[model samples]
Target: MALVEVKVPDIGDFKDVAVIELLVKPGDRVAVDQSLITVESDKASMEIPSSHAGVVRELKVAQGDKVSEGSVIALLEAQGAAAAAPSAAPAAPAVVEVAAPAPVVAPAPVAAPPAAVAAATAPAAGASDVGAHDPTRPPVGLPHASPSVRKLARELGVPLEEVRGSGPKGRITVEDVQAFTRAVMAGEQTTRAQAARAPQGGGDGAALGLLPWPKVDFAKFGPIERQAMSRIKKISGANLMRNAVMIPAVTNHDDADITELEAFRLQLNKEHEKSGVKVTMLAFLIKACVAALQKFPEFNSSIDVEGGGDALILKRYWHIGFAADTPNGLVVPVIKNADQKGILQISQELAELAKKAREGKLSPAEMSGATFTISSLGGIGGRYFTPIINAPEVAILGVCKARMEPVWDGQQFVPRLMLPLSLTWDHRVIDGAAAARFNAYLGQILADFRRVLL
Candidate 1:
């Protein structure tokens, strides 16, 4: 089979499932078992992975579409034998039709000799071919199209530049290129400006309208050694970049007087010292956050972009995730149901979760399903710093070093331990006034542990 229609796989006991997200778009190359879409039913949300490695030719379902078992989700150009075999002669003409948009040589005929099999199966191989992906090419400056679209464009002899993009931010969609080809074939007056301003694969920074990323030889000035980043950093870097760029984030800075709270914590530890569970500040913070979440439910909700980007999914359960610094990188271990647990229980759970995180033994379930997160740098001695909001959760609390500073108590200055709080939130979900109030209320709760009871 040259092309395959990817259908919804066996989803036990679910029907008319709403698509929550589309992970792969038309023209993207996908690996076997790679997630293509996320569907949410009443019971749970699950990702649908590709069963075959191939290039996505067309998306049959979009976000918010209700799909059932055997529903065609996408069309794919199967890789390897399914795509290259001479026995697939029946679909050769259709394959040729899809390739009409690209400027590539034709595949060998069905009756070609065995010696030409490899050449027939191989994709076009011109380094300058816009459809032929050049590994050395700087991917940033080139026209945006999926791998399948580029392949189709190559087959159709359509330079992507001549086709005006109708997709988001001048992105060339498959339809756009196909329409351009139709116009050209109909003998309509179409300008071939693409040939004049052709993208030079790796060297065309002018296409993206941005300065090229500076490449430097640091070894020339000083001795340098190359070291690979840790697995956690490498993975988290991409997520951090996407979140930072996409989210309109705002950080509200505040100070919490933990003078009395710290003393109470020490007393609690002294009281439970023999119990083998020491109460930590993070436990109290978790409890305080849960309380705040209950009071301000909006802060505990996620904007459902999959649901048309206008709805918020309010979570009733409070699962607090705390950032743990391991030798590898930062990891967050969520304490499920922090709202139901006492300080001692929360502290014990946090300790176990932190231990598991440090050992890299934390399960996926342990790290997921968090309603809120806290990143504390109090141990490392930072005054204040903005923390990135972990997506799906609208906010993150960043705690910094607590220092004993003199405070004017109406008449005299008294030394009080002030813990710095940096609350970062998505501006789309939270206003400045609301964020300020939240930070203030959090500080108030920390200043007087009694407020938690009230």
Candidate 2:
């Protein structure tokens, strides 16, 4: 039987997407087009499907490892029966031998530092002589561990070689990696000791200049259980950190009188209830934002990274992304051509996308190409929040609960519904005056929907 290498398919412009889950293991029979692993970018999560029907021989990449298109993800032993089918089967590629050994030792409990853990768990590109970022060739010896253990190590950033395995025949276990990381972070292990275990300059997260994360044994205080972060959090966290650090953000808070808008929305909802198209505040918000964006084209632009951040790419069309909360985490599903969409159409699509997001069914295309974003906390009852601007979009609007407030009208105070709005923008592109004007304009449009025509 011929062995074939399975690679990642075309996943669009994203690079270095993290492998989040493995769908198959060695000895498992996989059919053509079956998912082999799930990889997640900051925008969306997708599964890599198998191109050939075969038995899983070995997985090449582990969860937490960043991969690009064409990166080998697994090796498969091609099934002979698959060749006889009418469909054109993928041709076998070069063969790579994978060592299969049964575990001989039981893993013991342990903990370690994040970088050391990543080093210990993630496979190096080369042996002791290889540089961390070298791309010349493959590493000499692969680490020994199940895919799940390898994944855990990658998440923790532990080098498998540095971690001492307590499992049979010195097989590394999750506890061993954790113990190693704790020792490294707590300064129990010297720099020399860490260097000896893994090819060391420093661990993965070492360049941040931040002090080592404090290690705490929560069980010492009370009953405790460790739950791993969801894949969405792991992927989105990095993007959030980057956006927060690289972008100089400024947030402006304002209020919009939505009493009339709310009444109109309710009337529309009541009228359309039988039509099955429900009206939502978000739909109106989306339309109002589109009007503001049209008035201020600079707010509908992104910093062109390839242009050394000196140029802006102003989108001619309006595509808005709304943050949707799900069981997994927050995901932004973009509504394309929002400028051309009516309130009812936008509301229907928003509901559909939100449903898909909650169900984890949103595709990568549905999550990309947002010219601007809105994070609404109205349903959850928050007053205001500084929403991190979704790069490379320059601005994001945060919406909060609407409340009845006393408004001064001429000589009398009257009750009106006021909606809180928090507009956060990149200071590099938008100054305080522009941001203030943008917010004021957005508020005006929301207060009186007819203003959108101007």
Candidate 3:
């Protein structure tokens, strides 16, 4: 039997991935392609599969251990050639045993309870008991604990019922169980005073003072400590800062007359309810942008070369990315072939992508490949703000809050829903006039709400 070491495969551009789960253990038999461990990066989670059909001999990594490409994950004992091959064996015949008949006995009938017999003979109660237990009684194992305590207990693998409380009404304090656990693990006598006075570390805190506290002296300390940037954050930060510095970004503010667009959204929503698609203003905006791009193909194009070798690269297909805020950081999940998808389809896809992103479930594929981007802070309070262009994409459209503002009509000022559009574009490729023209065309399309529905 040959023992083969299973090392981590090359995941593109990812390093120091943390092992999140161990799918198999030592001595367990695993088939080829069966998952051995699961690792998670900031962008996505992936499973490492067994390279060969064998028994797991050892696991080199544990949960929370940071790993990189070519890191040894486990050792597998290869199955013998004889074990791998199938044997052609005959089946065994079934045998039946015969038994002799014995003396027969008459069985006695069971006597029913007097109350039950009376109930069957007479009328039943308004609500018969029928062997039912009382509904008013609380269910078993349901402890009287606060939600916070329950959450902590679940995280710490501590049973709430087993923990002795020190708070009001027998409430469990976080420190109480943590101290108990430390004492037990250390094999030390559990003293109430010592447990209570155990230093609460790990979190950031300062010492209390009787008078005014002295300020921290940075001069007394050596060199400051610096944390390495995460892969996603590092990329995002560098790209954003580079875009800001390199691009002469300009913004154009405009409002779409979405009265008819709103009505159309409501109408489409009624028809698409069974399909589970929601028609929102953003859906219409995406459609409008796509249509406008088709009319002004230059806007969809990118400036490939600067100065000496000046040329524009016009993309044939539209892959618009939507910036999604995740727990880890901001991620831009692309919507491929946006020009081909209808408003309803776009809405459904966007919803799914947003849901996955927020849940930290977006795959790495979903977070890459974009020709353009759209970022909306309309859900928040901002009216308008310049958005940084995502790298490789020439421009990013920013959507701000839509508010009811008085606008002057032909006769008088009327309250209309106004949406702010802030477009930031890379100056290396796109000229100011071209950018203004692109924004103007998009504005016109949005203002003509009937065009969007059609």
CA lDDT, every model vs. true structure: 0.72, 0.73, 0.64
Estimated TM-score for each candidate: 0.59, 0.59, 0.49
> In model 3, which runs have C-alpha deviations exceeding 4 angstroms?
1-231, 305-309, 452-454
- Model 2 regions lying over 4 Å from their true place: 1-206
lDDT of 2: 0.73
lDDT ranking from best to worst?
2, 1, 3
Of the candidates shown, which would achieve the greatest lDDT relative to the real structure?
A: 2
For residues 156-178, write the lDDT of model 2, one tens digit per residue. Answer: 55566556554432344455555
What residue pairs are clashing in model 3? none
Look at candidate 2 and tell me the lDDT of residue 67: 93
C-alpha displacement of 452 in model 3, angstroms? 4.8
Cα deviation in Å at residue 16, candidate 2? Answer: 30
For candidate 1, the 10 contiguous residues with the lowest summed lDDT are: 90-99
The count of residue-pair clashes in candidate 2 stands at: 30
In terms of lDDT, model 1 sits at: 0.72
